[model samples]
Target: MDHPHLPGPAARHAPPEHPEGTAHAATLASFDRGLRREARPDGPGCRVERTGRVVRQTGPRHAWNGILWSGLDATNADAVIADQIRHYDALGLDFEWKAYGHDGPADLPARLLAAGFTAEDEETLMVAEAATLPRRIDLPAGVRLVPVTDAAGVRLVTEVHERAFGTDSAHIGRQLFDRLASAPDDVAAVLAMAGDEPVSAARLELYPGTDFAGLWGGGTVASWRGRGLYRALVAYRAGIAASRGHRYVQVDAADTSRPILLRLGFTPLTTTTPYVHAPATVR
Candidate 1:
């Protein structure tokens, strides 16, 4: 069995190369490739395209959250990006944006600061080799980890998720569980329990499309922290991934959990930030 982290069938539509770890030019080239899938609406000033759901800032001068790039058109360059920002602002999505240092024109980040955007904490892009990944961890405390497959179990995961992330995302849980239920036997969920109560929980996503399977939503209760539950869950997930023929595991991690991932043989390669924009204004 391959490790869960390996790229597999889950990625049939993905490009041959992910624009990560490449030098400036190569990286842009990689993004250019993905452009075929997600990029469009090229022009001066910013416009919301993709059925008006995505905000596209052209001419290379906009502040967007976490990795949104602006075109570096020499004419009206900075203003164009700023127009994109203001346009999004008009849409009421003026909270904050994150951009990777290596994306867009070389000076994009600096320009974003000049436009009132702030640089917050930076986290690592971690990837793990699942084949070498370890499993066989003992449950910490009284926590009993179980593989969830039923509707009730899925609801348990959703409950734990809402408490942990401060969002009413039951729809996401439903989607995950539905996929898991319909998902071939290779993909699975492992929920951690404590005395019949669902506290710490996580899920494993095995992509038959790529050599990579992702481990996501490892949430533990406050009291459960410092115990080995999270690590054990990760190990458990990794073992399942390994058994499913995956080799690489990737996660976009937050600051609080960076060190733990580092200790577990995950390597930080690059950072990706999510840029959020609302409807209206730019439309």
Candidate 2:
């Protein structure tokens, strides 16, 4: 299923005057290295490995299992992809091969499709300097933004996610909870609520040795849309990223959040699509 919170393809406003090429290179490099080194063992059942230029992440036994940061040449792309598929197949795991617009061997997408991988929606890779994001976003009259700490907070976040995206977020919530328990300072999960009811939620992942901090799962319930909650969440997460010394804040924006991110000074670096291979079913 398409993640409903994915930001759109169009930018509502003109992209700001930023060093587009430089920022894009830096963000992508940081992401490749940072994710390889920092985003591993995300929860109890998860693990990450580097094979050649591909970073293979498996388990949590959820939808996030995939191969990332692939930079293979034409000579080896097919073999490498086949190896990955066989490896995951042996484990009975469904996985995705993430393809970026700027990725090499430009025919990689075609190869994946030919190999029976189905493409998900392509999303813009939005990035910006943390210090450049707006900081003073105002919340609606009854809405309040708070950092998630306990199990209840985790539940609220998952609730908002399920309602906003129409998917079961229990796995995501469990991973977040595990991260918070093991490395509290490395991750931040925030929730927005009207009185005592949850309405919006987002997460910030701080990569200690990299220049980027990632924004994930930013979503608001249907009734809460257009109320500035999403922007507020962005600003709030950006503030945390800046304080943590990250120079850039990056998000894979879907159709819904793209415009909001663009207006807040994020540049569209490139587009990324995940080619998924589902586990074969028994007849």
Clashes found in each candidate (C-alpha, N, C closer than 3 A): 37, 9
Candidate models: Cα lDDT each: 0.58, 0.80
Could you give candidate 2's per-residue lDDT for residues 242-281 as a string of tens digits?
9999999999898777877888898886777778897666
As a whole number from 0 to 100, the lDDT of residue 99 in candidate 2 is 79
Span of 10 residues, lowest total lDDT, candidate 1: 1-10
Q: Give the per-residue lDDT digits (tens) of candidate 1, residues 137-182.
A: 8786687888887888889988887776677857557556556655
Candidate 2 minimal-lDDT segment of 10 residues = 6-15
Candidate 2 local accuracy as lDDT? Answer: 0.80
Error of 1 at 213 (Å): 1.1
lDDT of model number 1: 0.58
User: At residue 258, what lDDT does model 2 achieve?
Assistant: 80
